[model samples]
Structure formats: C-alpha cells, structure tokens
Target: MPDRITLTGLRVFGRHGVFEHEKRDGQEFVVDIVAWLDLAPAAASDDLTQTLHYGELAQLAADIVGGEPYDLIESVAGRIADEVLKDSRLSAVEVTVHKPSAPIPLNFADVAVTVHRGRA
Candidate 1:
C-alpha cells in the first residue's frame, strides 16, 4: 500500500438534489478524500514540494462541492476524484460525499457515495 493523505469532514453548502426545493434551500454536504502516493521523497527531504499539498486539495474539494449542482452524490464524487487525480504524483484516490439532509421518507443517519479511481 502507498502512503496516504486524507482530508475528511469538509462541510460545504450546495444546492444539489433532484427536488426543486432542495435546489432552492440547499444543504450541507460533507466530503472525504484519500490520496495515495509515494511519501518517501518528501519524508526524506522534509520538503513540501515532494508531496501533495492537502490545503489546496481541501480547497479544491470545497470549490467543487460549493460550485455546481448535481442530482446525485455519485457525480460529485466522480468530479472530485477526477480533479484530485490531475496530480501525477498521486496513483489513486477515494472520494466520499455525504448527504446528511437528503429527502428520504424514513429515518436515516446519512446518505453518501464513494468512488475510487486510479491512473489509467
């Protein structure tokens, strides 16, 4: 397994849902991202340049979650994965989008989608 960098519980308000009210009212969305890459270079040199900057990554995810509207969390996850993979240093990534305020008839804790992607 490769060294991992994780960012979790990034809360952003987005107007993303199938219902019109949901789009209008919006809700809080939580995002989690795990990026896999070699960490030896950064570890050895103690340099920020050799590794992925997680602050930037968090900002990127926040921007995606807060920018466009998507009917499904799956699309949101896919978009985050695609953007995170733009860094060649990362070999793979896992994105989880949690929709806590989904319009469901039953009592539930959360609704979420997770996507795993790798370099092709």
Candidate 2:
C-alpha cells in the first residue's frame, strides 16, 4: 500500500461529449493511473505474476475510453477506476481522465476528472 505503480499521459481518441458535433468529430483523451499494491512480492520473487502488468493496464484504459461514449468525464474516470481495481492485488487505484478538447468556448489549458477507488 505504501508503494505504487504509475502510468501517465496515455492518450487516445474518443467520441465522448455532450454535443453532437463533439461526439461525431471526436477528440483526444489522456489518462493517468496510479495502482497501489505491495511491490515487495514482485521484487523478491522477480516474477511478473506477482505484480500488475502496465501494458495490460494501459490497453484496458484505452479500450474503455475508445469503446464507450459517455457524457461526463466523471463517468469515464469512474469506469477506469473500476476496471483497474478489478485486480485483487491492487489495494486502491487513482484514475485521471483528461479532456483537452472540451467544448468550453473559452481559453483553457485542459480539463480533467480524477477518481479514487479502494477495495471493500
């Protein structure tokens, strides 16, 4: 729980937005994930089976963002958090969904939603 594996700036294109134009045209979404788990086992055993594979994690996040259409980035974040937490090895997960091309009709660097979920 004290140690974590983090993946940042994983970008993918998705058609997720409120407006029709936004959904049809699609936009870029960036995701950052922090998975909290005991690293000692993996380190001592020197086996991938003892830890979560980041490549698989990234693919799962990409598939969720690219496959589904959600009106709120909150929902997207929630989904990512939920999926990542499926692994029993993970004690908790933090997911951030970034929306750079949001339809705000104003100047802004980026918009994002972050969610944290832990096992019950």
Candidate 3:
C-alpha cells in the first residue's frame, strides 16, 4: 500500500475573481492538499528527507495564493496540481480551493474547486 499524506485547512488571502470589485478587493482562500507516496522509509528512519514536508507544501500554497490575480479558481487548482506533480515521489495529488467570502449576491456559505492529478 502506498503511504498517504494530507494537509488541509490552509488559509490565505489573495485576489481571484471575475469581477473588477473582487480583483480590487482580495478575499480569503482556503486550500486543501493531499499527497500520496511511500512513507515507510521516512517513518522507519525518522528522517524528513524520506517524506513530504507539509510545512513546505503550505508555504508553496501561500506563494501560489499570494501570486498575481487569477480569473478562475480552476486555473489556480490546475497550477497547484502541476506544482505538486513536481515531486518525483508523489504518486497522486488532490487540491481543493475554498473561497468563503465570495462576492455572491445570494446567501451562500462558500465556493470551492477540487482537482486531482496522478503521475504520468
């Protein structure tokens, strides 16, 4: 079985929207990331090199979120998937982006986009 790792509920502020107002006024974005790999070595050796560092992953997410504005969450999600795939040990990854304070007219809790990618 492949060892699995997950990092969730990462919060960040960024500008992502279709409307001019939203782009002008940034919003809060929550990110969830899941990475799957063989973690047996890291678990046995107690070495960080043998496993994924979620801290770094979170930092990467922050960087992505803080980057220039995006027209859609789908684009952001796609970029995240591509970035995660950069790790050779990763077999698959899932990214979910949440926009809690979306500028919607009606009442809603939040909006989100989820994307998954596997090594080619």
**Index of the highest-TM-score prediction:** 1
Q: What's the candidate order when arranged by decreasing TM-score?
A: 1, 2, 3
Per-residue lDDT tens digits for candidate 2, residues 1-120, read 468999999999998989998788999999999999999999999999999999999999999999879988899999999989989989999999999989898999999999999988
Score candidate 3 by lDDT.
0.90
By lDDT, the candidates rank as 1, 2, 3
Local distance difference test, per candidate?
A: 0.95, 0.93, 0.90
Residue runs of model 3 more than 4 Å from their true location after superposition: none
Residues 1-120, candidate 1, lDDT per residue (tens digit)?
899999999999998999999889999999999999999999999999999999999999999999899988899999999999999999999999999989999999999999999988
Give the poorly placed runs of model 2, Cα more than 4 Å off.
none
Candidate 3 lDDT at 51 equals 93
TM-scores of all predicted structures: 0.97, 0.97, 0.96
Residue 82 lDDT in candidate 1: 98
Question: Which stretches of model 1 miss by more than 4 angstroms?
Answer: none
